[model samples]
Target: MNEVLDDPVSQTMIDIHCHVLPETDDGSVSLEESVEMCRMAAADGIKTIVATPHLFDGVHPPPSRDDIRRKIDLVMEASGGVVEIVPGGETRYSHEIFQEARDKHTRIRLNGSSYMLLEFDFMMVPPNIEMTIFQILQAGLTPVIAHPERNARIQLKPEILVGLIERGAYAQIDAGSLLGSFGKECETSVKQILRAGLAHFLASDGHHQDRRRPLLSKAVSIAAEIGGERYAKALVEDNPLALIQDRGIPFQPEPDLAALRGRAKKKAAKSWYAFWR
Candidate 1:
């Protein structure tokens, strides 16, 4: 069991996605920034944050497992154990990458659990998303699609997200999107996903100390307003905690695929009409 799970104290929030490791990627620039990020999370009532640096994207190679462990230890120590940092990786989409993950040759799984945080390009969904998600499930890991609501493709065609969910992949909504920090399009997508019960987790994809900080209180409140209190808490707290502990989400709700497609078609029709106007 994780030390966080072992502790009896209850935490109101758990951010499953955060780039808080110092100098690891484009996240916190230094050790002080990483510690400051933890302070910010703790202040926002976030007792746990997964230190997910980017992996296998041809951008920046992730740190070694040993280095990540060392940084987690350093950050935890610096935070005086107020907040726990779990090990994870935000991996880009690719058949080979998902294959490696399924083979258990990669430690990039979230907190060493069977849940993998998978990301697609902002402007497009991968052509092999369905097959890749099937492969992930076959490999004994669940694919948690990171911040689908922020993806331009998903924002335009939410049916893409409905398809992924129907194929057994989960979706994580960015806290910034719910808080309208990303933009109007992302915020609209957040509301749509919430309405369809497709958003399974909420995370602070916190990259820096101030601008993209680990602030989730407002997002949580907004989620509650949109989906009711139980659903809201499940997104930011219950589901993420279960992922960290390698347990199934206690409040998994079935995605409303029919409603999602209907909304997407209606939106598309409106756009087509406007194009001719």
Candidate 2:
């Protein structure tokens, strides 16, 4: 497990959507694979990352948070602090799905650290989408919308995101989407999110070793190009730190989406709540 430990930048980036745990879901299938991914993330200049395994109805059968932490401890022992894996999970948005996740032990929270990461179905918009978001917020946790840009229905109606933002929902685009790594539509939509300023957080949503490899460096570059390095750093670094520490994340937006998206085209992570049931 202690294969690679010479991670140089132990003070820079904090990846928001890495799945470095083994076998809980579609992340690294084993502990050794998770270690390798951590090494790769460390090489890519990430200092810290959340191990957001999939917490959905279809995949994992709701693992315990204690179990999740035990695995993280294993990875921590293996990596020797080269990369720290915290307890978090990429949760699917369904009261039913979340009910299943409540049995889980390690559930990843939102960037604000007030809520958890939550993803909806990509094939169609969730029923009562806005109301569901409100319910999540009413539950005393921030509602982070995971990769809304990839959702086909939202893509057709970009203005939906404006409403989401107006109602206090935070939107995060997948790291791969920023790089156009998902597909042309995801690429175009990411551009729109950036231009519209709809995206508040950027995450890797990484699941595998090859194409889905952890690359905060690339996202940093894009953020620099589109929204200055300091701003990018806030989403990947400061904001994330505040989240894990359970601190309030102040919203200081630069480009306003309601005004910005009036002339632009795109769209938008949440988790944790599924496991607390």
Best prediction by TM-score: 1
Off by over 4 Å in 1: 1-10, 102-105, 258-262
Q: Write the per-residue lDDT of candidate 1 for residues 184-239, one digit (tens) a residue.
A: 98998889899889899999999999888887888889999988999988888789
For residues 104-150, write the lDDT of model 2, one tens digit per residue: 22254532255687787887877687887776676566667888989
Each prediction's Cα lDDT score? 0.85, 0.71
Q: Please give the RMSD to the true structure for each candidate, in Å.
A: 3.7, 8.3
Q: Model 2 clash tally?
A: 22
- List the candidates' TM-scores in order: 0.91, 0.84
Position 204, candidate 1: lDDT: 93
- Clash tally, candidates in order: 0, 22
